[model samples]
Target: MSRFEEELKRDKFVCSECSRCKKIVWPPSNYCNKCLNETTWREISRKGKLVEYSYNKGECFGIVEFESQIRIVGTVKGSERPDVGQIMNLEKCDYDGDEIFIFSSTVQRNGSQNS
Candidate 1:
């Protein structure tokens, strides 16, 4: 398995860091977006909040922001409807034979939209 795939399967989520600037590059890149230096893999929080989202039919996708730094874009699924600033947890999911990533939110736990 490729390093990216292996990291996803083992750690759930990851972001790359620029060797020189030490800043994280989301969506995993070959090099830093700012400094153009080589990047290394780093594990991130599995939990975060939905900063923005939209869905077509039942499939949902959005940008989730971590507590401190970094944000990632990916699919999400949950019992209650998704909305901005809702807490969610990232997880590995399956789409046909491919390994995909998704988020399961616990928004209702905070006392809103229990559906």
Candidate 2:
């Protein structure tokens, strides 16, 4: 299959479609935080804009705004540029856990340059 198709077929197993807001939780609901009328196992657009980022000591953390949803913490791809506030695509990374996301190669928009 093509690379794009392969990406679409990638299994995002950890994502539980627990519709707590809908009062129908897949993993069982104790509290509904998102408060959406309904929640479904939908694939994220894979595209996002870097909203905030920080690097302390030797660790790095970034927040990406994916569509209408709030920002999510993400790991930058080793192959891609690690600049803060740069828009990128979410690609599966080879790291611990079920799946990891990385920034795409090309930057769609530029943020404030850091020293």
The Cα local distance difference test for each model comes to: 0.73, 0.50
Stretches of candidate 1 off by over 4 Å are 67-70, 93-99, 108-115
After TM-score superposition, the amount by which residue 97's alpha carbon in candidate 2 deviates from its true location, in angstroms, is: 4.6
lDDT score, candidate 2: 0.50
lDDT of 1 at 86: 74
Candidate 1 clashing pairs, residues 3+ apart or interchain: none
Please give the range of 10 consecutive residues that has the lowest summed lDDT in model 1.
Answer: 92-101
TM-score of 1: 0.69
Q: Give per-residue CA lDDT, model 2, range 1-115, as digits (tens).
A: 3232344356332222336544333332233445644445444556677776666555555777765354666665553336655665666543343334555534434664332
- Cα lDDT tens digits for candidate 1, 1-115: 6556666666456678888998788656879999999999877778887898888777788888874567767788765568788777886633333547688876556677644
TM-scores for the candidates: 0.69, 0.49
Best candidate (score: TM-score): 1
RMSD of every prediction: 4.3, 8.1
- Once fitted onto the true fold, the runs of candidate 2 whose alpha carbons sit more than 4 angstroms away are 1-36, 57-59, 78-85, 93-99, 108-115
